[model samples]
Target: MMDTMFLKAALAVYFVSVLGYVTSIYVRRVMVAKVSTWIFFLAFLCHTISFIFRYLETGHTPVISIYETLSFFAWAMAGVYLAFQPKTKTRVLGAFVSPVTFLLMIAASKGLEGYVSIPEVLKSNLVPLHVILSVTGEALFALASFAGAMYLIQEGLIKNKKVSGFSRMLPSLSDLDRINHFCLMWGFPLLTLGVLVGSLWARTAWGSHWQWDPKQVWTLVAWVFYALLLHQRLAIGWKGHKAAFLSLLAFAILLVSLVAINLFFVTAHSFI
Candidate 1:
């Protein structure tokens, strides 16, 4: 109950942050965006507190249900974006990030009354490690996609000779590409490790290293997709538009697969 209360509080604060970010973009005020970042941080702190309370109540990581998964994913998105702020010039990127986080929080709210019991197979400590690592990696990819989307918008404006005031408000194309590169470099390895850990857990729980379940198969597909993107990025010296486009493509496929797997197909991972 306390967790729920805190979650509601976080959601409210996140909404305000979203409004602040959008307002900053429209008004072209860096100061407002900076203030929004602080508000977003406050919301993240509340979200963190909510998770702690949920863990205390659940006696495990609170990622066992659709409600928890969406909440955790939203938290990861906000955390990853905030983490990047100090090292990068991405303050305006919150215009993209906040809305996505708010939507996730809203979706999470819809499932709040439908919390499912964790299956015995998911009780292993690996659940937290696998879920956290994988979800965080996915969050990074989400950031990459956002950056790529921004890059595309900025690129289009530049190419069309439509460099207006709004285009000027966006982060530099080079900076967006760098964020894309950084996220790809880091997200792939984290996701690989997460898959390996999940496989180990699967071996113990289901007596196999790999299951041909739709979820597993699709996850592998997504992994290989990113792996290829990373390989192209490093080996072939891909950057800028090409890299940004592929990152958006990969993330799009991954997002579609994730929803399809969880909603349309039955699998070991459907507990979420």
Candidate 2:
């Protein structure tokens, strides 16, 4: 239970990092951005330590509860950005990224009161694998959406003939577009695999391969949307504005499904 302290501790550090990122954006200071990067690294380390404690106590991946899932999603997102950092000039992107992770962490903090009791159904190993891959894929889609949002902002500024200060700070359109494409290329397959594994787990837990659970249906909806996006990208060579718009639209649908359906619907897939 004491390890839960680490989760709180990580939340505090992440808040400070988010502030730093905001400041970096306001001042347009590269040094502040650099400092923010290290702070984010420290926050990520705290989150990792927190996860280690949770895993030690739970004897499973620490994504069973809504709190844990939010934590896991934020951590996976930060880790993905860090992994992509060296290859991209996305340091400024942290202004966008930190807020998303921080918001998830904040939502997660409300439930860190104590150890969460795992449901007997969640004891299945498939549950953890499904959670891990599925959340990671979702997290990647989040990043792609973030990048696409930035791309549109930059593109709009260019089209409107406005050479603003922050526009100079934003990454090139080519870079953001490439990141979106790469994320989709990778996120689609990972999500597909996640759905497949979840099917296997559903068979084990419910003795049926398909159910009309709102959560499951929404997840399938997200999968199909991503699949269509991928098909357009590969076959029709869609990129730039239309592709970015579709990516954002897909993420919006996924968000509605994950949040709205999970909260209001009487679905068997509701874990929160």
Candidate 3:
């Protein structure tokens, strides 16, 4: 009962945060931005508490269900945004990001009926660590993809003289491109560490470092896509739309691996 109430409250706050972000885009009032920022911060706090309570209620990490996994990603997304806030003027990007986070929260809200439990194999400590690091790392890369996609969209509009509405709300294309590259450069190492940790965990549990499981195969594919992007950007002087396109390509791979493949396919690594 308490869990239900807390979850409800958390979802409410997430919705409020979404509205706040939308309002920030239109109002142009400094006071409005301040209010919305506070609202989002408050929403994040409520979400943190809700996740904590859920954790206390269940001994397992909250990565067992697709809903919970999405919720965790939303949290990590907000965390990454908050971290980058002071360093860069990416607050406008939040107008795009907050809605995504809200949708994830709403998705999480959809399926909470049963007492969720971890599978027997997933109860291991390594599995939990692997999930946490890998998911969080992926979350950062997801944000980078969002930034990169917007960068390309905005870049096209500027190239074609169509800057208005949400396009105007975005930062300069240069800034977006720079941040996109920055995010990949920063996120890649974490992602590599996550893959490494997960590989070690897999070897321990399944007696093979590489299983070619659907999850493993797709994850490696995503990694290689980003790896190629990094190489193109650094070694071959790729920039602007090219890099942004690569980022979008990597994001597509991630979506297929994270969402589509996991949903439709059977695999030994399907913890969710």
Candidate 4:
């Protein structure tokens, strides 16, 4: 009950914060953006309280079920956005982030609304660590691709000399590009670590590190795609459009691995 109450409260405040952000974008006001930012922070704090209560109720990490996992995933997305928003001069990004966060939370709250006890076989410590790390990495990639997409739109508007209020509200190309780059730079290593931990867990549970399950195989594919993004960004000095488009593509593949595999394929991950 506390979980549901707090979660609903957080969602309500978060929606207000999103409205503030959208209004700021349309009105082109820094003060409104700043207010929206603080509102977002408040919403995050409320969400954290819900998570805390959920954990106390469950006696374990509040990430076992799909909805719970998605909730945490949304939290990570907001956390990362909060961490850099002040410095990025990209308050306009709230236009994207707020909706995404709100949608994920909505999805999380739409399920059976009952606690799912963890299976005995999934009680391994590695399970929690793997989920947290993988979720965090995916959150980062999600932001990166969003930034990349924003970059393309802004770039197009600029090239066509569609200089107007909307164009002005968009973050500069350099800022968006930097966000895309920064997220990718960090996301890949985190994802790699998650994959490694997952493999370790697999070996412990099934006596085999490589199962070639749909989740495993597609995870490998996403990993390779991100690795290519990193290589192109670092080793090949790719930046701007090339990096942005590739990050977007990598994120799309990540969605397939995460959502498609879970829904369509019978894998060890789905079992968990």
In model 3, the Cα lDDT at residue 236 comes to 96
* lDDT of all predictions: 0.88, 0.86, 0.78, 0.87
Q: Please, what are the lDDT tens digits per residue for candidate 2 over residues 1-272?
A: 75578777878888888899889888988889889988888888888998998788768788888778888999999998888977887798888888888899989888877776777888888888888898899999999999999999999988888867668888899999999998888888887888888999999899998898888888888788888999999999998998898899899988887788867878888754
* Candidate 2 residue 269 C-alpha distance from true site, Å: 0.2
Per-model TM values vs. the true structure:
0.96, 0.97, 0.91, 0.96
How many residue pairs clash in all the candidates, one count each?
A: 0, 0, 0, 0
Better of 2 and 3 by TM-score: 2
Instruction: Return the TM-score for candidate 1, rounded to 2 decimals.
Output: 0.96
Predict model 2's lDDT versus the native.
0.86
**Candidate 4: stretches off by over 4 Å:** none
Model 2: number of clashes? 0
Could you tell me how far off, in angstroms, the CA of residue 215 lies in candidate 4 after the best superposition? Answer: 1.6
Preferred candidate (TM-score higher): 1 or 2: 2
What is the Å distance of residue 190 in model 1 from its true position?
0.9
- Residue-level lDDT for 97 in candidate 2: 82
After the best TM-score superposition of candidate 4, give how far the Cα of residue 272 lies from its true spot, in angstroms: 5.9
TM-score of 4: 0.96
Distance (Å) between predicted and true CA of 211, model 3?
A: 1.5
1-272 per-residue lDDT for model 3 (tens digits) = 45556767767876786787778778755456556656767777777777777777886776677888888888888778777866777677777777888888888878754556666767777766766777787887888888888888898888888876557678887888887888888778777887887788878788888888887788889999999999999999898998988888898888888888767999886664
Q: Which pairs clash in model 2?
A: none
lDDT minimum window of 10 residues, candidate 1: 109-118
Residue 85 Cα positional deviation in candidate 2, in Å, after optimal superposition: 1.1
Per-residue alpha-carbon lDDT of candidate 1 for residues 157-235, written as tens digits (9 for 90 to 100)? 9999989756898889999999999998888898889889988988998899898988878778878888988999999
